[model samples]
Target chain A: MNAIEIKNLVKTYKGGVKALKGVDLCVAQGDFFALLGANGAGKTTLIGILTGLVNKTGGQVKIFGNDIDVDFEGAKKSIGVVPQEFNFHMFERVQDIVVNQAGYFGIDDSIAVRDSEGILKRVGLWEKRRAIARTLSGGMKRRLMIARGLIHHPRMLILDEPTAGVDVELRHGMWEYLRHINAQGTTILLTTHYLEEVEQMCRNCAIIKEGEIVLLDNVRHLLTRMPQDTYRVTLKERISLEKAQAFNAVKVDDHTLDIEIKKREELNEVILRLAQSGFVITDFHPKGNRLEKLFLEIVSK
Target chain B: MKREYYIALKTILRKETTRILRIWTQTLLPPLITQTLYFVIFGKFIGSQVRSINGIGYMAFIVPGLVMMAVISSAYGNVVASFYGAKFQRNIEEILVSPTPDWVVITGYVLGGIVRGVLVGVLVFAVSLCFAHPMVTHAWAVVLFTLLSSILFSLAALINGIFARNFDEVAFFQNFILTPLIYLGGVFYSIHSLPKVWQEISLYNPLVYMVNGFRYGFFGFSDVDPGVCLLILLGLTVVLTCINLFLFKKGIGLKN
Candidate 1:
């Protein structure tokens, strides 16, 4: 039972801007899927089509086996989307926004109240439930969107840039909440620029480029495919350019060097060469995240 | 599934009603003050000098028309502002992405307009009672005409909101089209008082039938045939509703 299946999806905007050429992808039931793409790679358009916000030029979309064209309501009922933009009413109170969303799903008043409270509390917005939505901070607003998107207990949740503006602390909290819900069997389709988030949360990953899925595989498998890792090394003192050039390290500055290491290369060999050359390593870190490295590798290819 | 639409309708109704009440100063107060001014200036100050038109007290003659005008504006304004506000803020996507049907969304917004229109109409009518001893010759006719007129304007406003891209577009329809039609619809003076040439032109305005039909319900007298007026109103309501539904189905100016 796939949570979502899109086949040959096409979308050409009004002025002939081809947003999606022919995107095909699938997210297994209860899987946390990460959809990574560049700015104009049609990630938002794909999510818009799935949520019925954008009319597709061609292709088929199914949610939990219900075809969108054949059973529009059924397909819609199975999914909830948190769009990239803040689309909820700004004048309404935080509680009404979530409760009203539940109402649209045919949840009764009592249940709506209970669920709204539960979700609001989970999102740490219970205390501010009576406040107008616009008065809340940016992170709180993002959490409110999450609460509203989950009020109906959708089988699949699509979040587009959900943590774009969130701080590190709040982002971690939101990630925990998302993991909790996903653990409870809600399939989450997350689109994010934060590759670290995808590494931390998503099990299966798909990278879309130019409106098409160019890579789709398990997160670990994709990371394992990377043949080399780049690291930024800080030295105690500046080494001669010739000494660094012998190891083919790029001198970033007087005391810093950028080094690339193959997966099977011995770290001691590189460090020993620097050591023998009178260079003492002070600090070292990967230049980029593993997923990010792979993402850049695949997209650039 | 059977309960889905009903629940959505109820939720939307509650939200819209809350919205209407939340901003009472903006939504309700302006119409009350505006209509009251009309009664005092047009019905008392100028109406005294004019005496009576069509053998009825001038104040009483304009009461139905004034109330009808309020109904049209309030109903139309409520839906137009509310729906366009939804569009402007992009919050309409909440319902657009849900399982709620398009008809349910239309009905919810139309009913919101109707509620505001009817409430304003009744309030104006109550205010009219202080100025003129207006009597309802057919209570059912008054209710029927008021409901029909509200529905008509509500649907019209929905159409306007759907086509409107910005606040200026919404105001353009109201000021250029709606306000002018209402004025020429014979709110202050009876069309019969005008020269036969202008009277002939007035007949082309659909609002004349709505105003006359409502006036007929109050005094059992009308400038046009009340039966014809009712049929015309019914026909227009059907047409506007069909057009609105078609727009929603096509997602015009809504989905992209």
Candidate 2:
């Protein structure tokens, strides 16, 4: 069964802003899905419609077989959303925010209290349960939102830019936790600006541009479609500019070269040539976000 | 109501009650302090100088009106501030995204208002008793009018919170619209004291009926017929309820 199914979804705001344009998408149960789009590309709007936060102009949406227009309460019962912004009560303690959200879903207080402890701890916020929400740092606030979203234990979870401003260490931690939940049988639909997150966490992704889906496929397949791979390679010794140019490498510095490898075999061949020229390779890594390169490629088109 | 909606309703009420008691200075004490001053200045100082209305002492005559005023303000203030705060902080999305139906949301908030409004009303009435031994001709009318008026104002306040877009708009409706209506609703004096034309116009103010109906409970005398007042209150209550339910259904001033 599909976790979410959207057929011909459309949303046009006042003053003629077409936020969404007849978008069709689906995510199967227990799958980790990513919806990638630039700002104002209608990613949030589509989520809003599914969550009943925004009225849809026209379309059909079903959550776990419950039609949004016909059985909204049933559809809503199966899903939880952690919005892009912090929307919980700032004056309340961290635990209260999560427990109260459970209450909104009709969970008993006793059950919510019991559930929040586990959820908060899972999000690494059990120690901050008594602290006021506004007092927590931005990352903690984001975690608190995640805790609240999970308190009801819905079958499907939607997170929008969950780690937008988070530091690298915390971002990795979030990625690990999300992976853990997806493995535990909770389907996740994530939208993030961090293409690295998509590469690491999402199994399937759809790139949305101008309110339309431009590409949809397996994450691995999408990466393979990139015609070239850019790498920043560091060397133990400097190589002459003439030798570097011969291999079409940009001399970032005497000891560093920026090279674009067109094929997997080409990378091996280039390394062999550099080694023969007495330029020892010290370290190597992708120059930038590989998925970001493809994302820019698709959206800009 | 479903079991879940009932649970959600209780949750909303519990949260609201906690807030009222937690911030007693803002929600409870201000009305307590304000009403005490009304009993002191209006009933003691200025009241002594004025003659009795309808053969009742001025101090005793204004008791019911003052109590109703507190209920109106406290109930209206509670819903608008709390709900508007939710909207401003976007925390209202907490309930909006839930499975709780629109009626449950409306009931939860209006009940919260009634809780604060009636609590303040009771406190003010107790304070009035210390100054004057106001007669109670019909105890049921006192309780009935209090509930009806609180519910009406609370429904009205929820509408205000819905239409309000910013903090300034919240205060604007309370100051410019509600305050004028309550004061001119015959709180300080009887509608009988106004000129013939003004008395006719005063009947158009819904609060005049509310204040007089409540006074009818205490002194057994009123400027408007109690039966007519009851019908008007009930009718307005239904109208305000319909309007509020419609807004919630349409997600007016709430969803984009």
Q: Interface RMSD of the predictions, in order shown?
A: 0.7, 0.6
lDDT for position A88 in model 1: 92
Q: Per-residue lDDT of A1-301 in model 1, one digit per residue for the tens?
A: 7998999999999999989988888899999999999899999999998998999999998989999899989998888889888989999999999999988888898899998999999999999999999999999999999999999999999999999988999999999999999999999999999999999999998999988899999998888788988889999997667766787788888888888889899888888888887888999888879889778877898
The alpha-carbon lDDT assigned to residue B64 of candidate 1 equals 97
Question: Could you tell me the TM-score of chain A in candidate 2?
Answer: 0.98
Top TM-score: which candidate number? 2
The Cα local distance difference test for each model comes to 0.92, 0.91
Q: How would you encode candidate 2's per-residue C-alpha lDDT over B1-256 as one tens digit per residue? A: 6899999999899888888898899999999999899899999999999999888899998999999999999999999999999999999999989998988888898899999989999999999999998999988888889989988998998999999999999999899989999999999998878999999998889999899899999988898888888999999999999999899888898898
Docking class of 2: high
User: What is the C-alpha lDDT profile of model 1 across B1-256, one tens digit per residue?
Assistant: 4788999999999998999899989888898999999999998998999878767899999999999999999999999999999999999999999999988998999899988999889889999999999889988889999999999999999999999998999999999999999999988888888999999999889899999999999999888999999999999999999999999888888989
For candidate 1, give the lDDT: 0.92
Best by DockQ: 2
Displacement of residue B73 (Cα, Å) in model 1 is 0.1
TM-score for each of the candidates: 0.96, 0.98
DockQ score for model 1, please?
Answer: 0.87
Residue by residue across A176-202, what tens digits does model 2's lDDT show?
999998999999999999998999999
